[model samples]
Target: MYSPEFRREAVAALKTSTLAEVAANTGASPSSLRRWVGRSDLADRPRSGRPPIQDTADQVVEALVATAGARISGKDYSTRALAEATGLSQSIVSRSVRGLTVPLTDVGGGRELSLVAAGFPLLILGARTEDAGGEDGGGGPAVPPRRIQRRIAGIAAALRSAGVGRWAQRFDSEHRQVPTDNLLELIAAGGSDRFLVFDPLGEVPVEVVAESDSRVEVHRDFAEFLEALKDLLAGCQDIPGSLLDLLSARVRNGLEGVLWRDSVGVDASRSSMSSDSMEISSWLPKETRSITEHLAIALREEIIDSAYEPGDRINPRLLSRRMRVPRASVDAALRRMVDDKLLDGSRGGARIPLITTGDVLDLYAARMAIGEVVLRSLSLRPQRYLVPVQLALRQVEASAPTRSGIDVEDADLHYQQELARASGLRESARVFEAVTLRLRLFISVLQLDYSPASDRIVSDDRAMFAALSRGDAKTAIEVWRGKVDNAVRHMAGLLGRRRFDQELWTQLTRSLA
Candidate 1:
């Protein structure tokens, strides 16, 4: 039988892979994998008394606390406002608030809810008394057992009033079961704006706030956390420039502690652990991508940056030594990239594929056909589907004037990928991504040796954006067709300069026509 930890690792792998893939990697049957996922709760056990609390109830209580904090800070406390702040539905918030037994008075005949004066002290005390518990006696700081009990009572009362009494009881009891470091990593990777960890007393001893550039500010004190919350609320309503300025100020304040040691430092620290042990331990955190996946991405970047030329063989042993990962992992990554057509695996090993003029034309033709379908679907969808597309276009525009051709190419590729994703065509998006992988090799070669011109890329993309925005699918397709034809001609010219066969090039061009 697999251990709980083994099952947990398998479930984690399922997040970024298919069930069959996980089963093949783990040597487990598909049925067993499904069962493990179904029963993957870390705290799986039978409760003796009352029914178990649902995750939705937990979400509601957390939202209520955030709402309460905002209300006390003089922000808008209406259901709609609370929903926006907590990323919950307005109907859920309204239903939860109505169910709560807390003494709340209705403003505008129940259109808005306000906690009674006595309730405020309980929430404030609950927030303040929530200590990290290990601080006393060189651990950090200590609170009296009686004070802890009082804090628990107050928070439990609030939760009980909200019909989550069972959850309140489980709060203190289950705190130790949580893997703190793993939870922090997961929160850092999640999309939530705010996350709070209560320490039995309903006091938030750990709070994580998402910041720009994929960073998170972790606040450890209730007062300090409340101040950060105010900033978050203010930043949300402010203009983009002002919001970035405020974020920069906050980042500067915490820069010292935020800097982490590089992989070399981590490697140095892992000397005591066996390599097998380290590999197993790394798989425990769901937020941490698999080693093979990381290696694949790193190798992909190397290829896209033209570190390897066409027909150059990839040495897994040398890469393993250079990257400080197991050779097996490097081999697996090479195999994955080969499967994606980013590398050719013939001649008994993986190597960069030599590009042919016909190959370029074929890739562009496939991309054009897929792009037409995606663009048409996108035009038919609601306007909100274009948000990511717009952001990607902005990146392309911003990088156009930069001296780095690599930057411009990267942005343009991302814009196309985003366009595919926003189209809501999953299969088309997947195929488009595979086609783009081969296209990246050509683009890299052009950027490195040929210095292919890209003057029209930004203008063409902008025009397509405008067409898609106006729901003009015909114009968008025409613009895309023009862009593809331009790319084919440019690549053909580059190949001609390199002395490819004239007869083959002519035949390929005819097929395109």
Candidate 2:
């Protein structure tokens, strides 16, 4: 067992004993932080199920301040005018949204986020080996092949619908038949350098919105963010992370219905396709009376979207800048909201806070436990994992030619998040939020000091897959158990052991079993 004292030592070295503050004081390079983030066992394993956003709220007094891009010019509450606006006896609007779950409900449309202008789409390119030439000439298709210009528009919509980020219409609104060769060109032109790329030898469209001038960026201290999140998870808070989940789930589910064509008939209106494509009523634009409120809401989601799973990690400041707002304004809003308890950001890695704190943890524990059970259940698919594991090893062999401006989340997370979805584990989508929460919280605390690689996740997921292929349920159990064990150890180093517990895991497993 890992000693809780490690977390104490890590904490002792900090200015405020918060992950963000300590990570800043440590002066470790971002690359080192990335590596340490994953090396809890020297292998990249995905972190999952953090607390929810409903735990804390961002309170910059939306009506008083207008969100940057929306451009609200109003006679509402500013820092000094809060008492008169809503008959509340406060002076600053910045101090208003605290501890309230329905922050936006109180402020009106002025405090909401928009669906546009949030991210650039990043699409993974691929070429089939058979297309290159037959057996004698055995090289996979060129880096990018010669094909028609096509953008993964459907994918873009799905991502946006999932609240991943806003889909950049410039390059992605419609699917253009793009050639395999112009891939990098497209990436440079419309693709954001800040993205979580998931290319497992296929044609996948994924992207990340980038943060500008990392140095000047200001954020909620990561350690405190994580600690607060952990505290909320321990039932020290009153709000619910699921409340925000309500927003995302409703939106994504609606989008998912549109994407999967779940809700429409074959001959639906030209403007209204099935739920699989464009049948997303929830995707419609909402009116914004208060730009600041909407801006804060968007930032909150952006922060969550920037979770550090493996390849996709981002800074909330990145979203703030992209939203065209001042960093101070964003932070002020976040501070006030958190001070009141609207967003719960306990995962302790990225700047985005997880809305659901405690349940997020329980969800993670439950999901992992279920994953373990699934691995054991699938003990006959060892061969199915061979190619993936081999490819992964080869990937590490290439030494990532040049590092990405944004680090990749553990491959294990990518695989498992999908598997969780495949298993039809009711919480597949919810788990995505949970995983992101931890990464966001972690990123907030570590910044440049955060280095996350998924060697352990690879080892475990592969081993379990292999075990399943081999029909060795026991081996799957062992491998998966190890994976969770390693993650717990790593997290314990960052968050106090007292912050984590067996109840969540035990309850999760009992249900899973």
Candidate 3:
């Protein structure tokens, strides 16, 4: 079925254009077009049906048969005994019992079980969750209750932010299970406006499946499942949330320009501004700045965002054409950034700065010292500085660190840059931004030699944000120091160097102080 927006667009088009034209524009069949026009509304609604229930008996029977087939020390279950254990009628249990893929002997009146004396694929669901609070640290299921609760809370927050909080409350997350064939049957029967979560029991490498409108989306884990849910709710008219709503206002507001630029790549020069690109550009902050200032800000954002990786050449000619500006303006911006130490122009051209083991140690020492001073300053004037830090935190929270190469790193640096800009110590903040840029570029270069844990970077930022929000300067600085120390340690190992020059490190630390 066509979405409400598509139907409305078609109706509006029909007022000025022919039905055939509308059909062509919408990719809707002529019959579908007529029906859409005939309908007063195209909103998705739940189909009339009874609430779906699982075939507990069938599943219970399957479990019993599998268990009995194992023949653990010659123990077995009769049909009547199985019915009692499973709370099903004996007749139902009898009918539910089926031949297993693995052969077992029916020894006790064709009821006793024996394992097949043949080689066969035996599926084992041996996956384990985090140990629970028991003597043996035994958990009933692989998915721990605390983990499930956290996921549910996260979903609630996403739904609430998406303006579907009322609908979200109706879901009993504690009752969440993997959708089985029986559950899918009922859901398909019930039709639109149905949402379900299912996790199969004892399946190693468990998958979460979401089915709707004869379509199934399978996710490998809870995180991916949440991402799928976000997509679903964002697209559903019934949810009252757009894709933009899934992201923070700051991200949604700024992302279009960034995304468009990324998509166009080197060929941005050849293409005219698309309608979508124009719309995105229009949403950008309309500052009355010169082309040079704009170019510098854009480049700085890309650098801070890690869009420009270490060793990536900043081709002035390509940039000038891509941004539709003068070469001199681009050149001027490059020179300004180079002067600010945000980019390196040492070899032949402006490029992302590279670093060595010595650079890493000195940068971390400076960053740690700068962070201490900045946190102290923020503690003195939390009211003045905390708001922007919180605002930047939202921007980072809205971004997905795991989905992209640059997004997580970019978001991490972007917020730190914001915090630095908000710091009362202007000189310290300036030095922090330069040092951060240098460190991130160095890490990017290090990635060419060894893989680094990007998630650690994101986690540190979150920890720092949490501390900063509480006006806990000491803890925030400690977290910040830990982040720097981690990067330095990793980079030092990659360089086969144990330590940086002690004299140079002392000088950099003194500068931050």
- Top-TM-score candidate index: 1
After superposition, candidate 1 runs with Cα above 4 Å error? 1-297, 304-307, 321-325, 446-455, 497-513
Estimate the TM-score for candidate 3. Answer: 0.39
lDDT of each: 0.51, 0.34, 0.47
403-430: candidate 1 lDDT, tens digit per residue: 4455566677778888898999999988
Pairs in clash, predicted candidate 1: 135-140, 135-141, 136-141
lDDT of 3 by residue, 122-208 (tens): 100111122234321222211112222222222233222333212223333322332234333433343232332322232212232
The residue pairs in collision within model 3 are 177-198, 177-199, 178-198, 178-199, 179-198
**Relative to the unseen true structure, what is the Cα RMSD of model 3?**
27.7
Better of 2 and 3 by lDDT: 3
What CA root-mean-square deviation does each model show from the true structure? 29.2, 27.4, 27.7
Where model 3 places Cα greater than 4 Å from the true spot, the runs are 1-314, 341-354, 440-455, 492-513
Quote each prediction's TM-score.
0.41, 0.30, 0.39
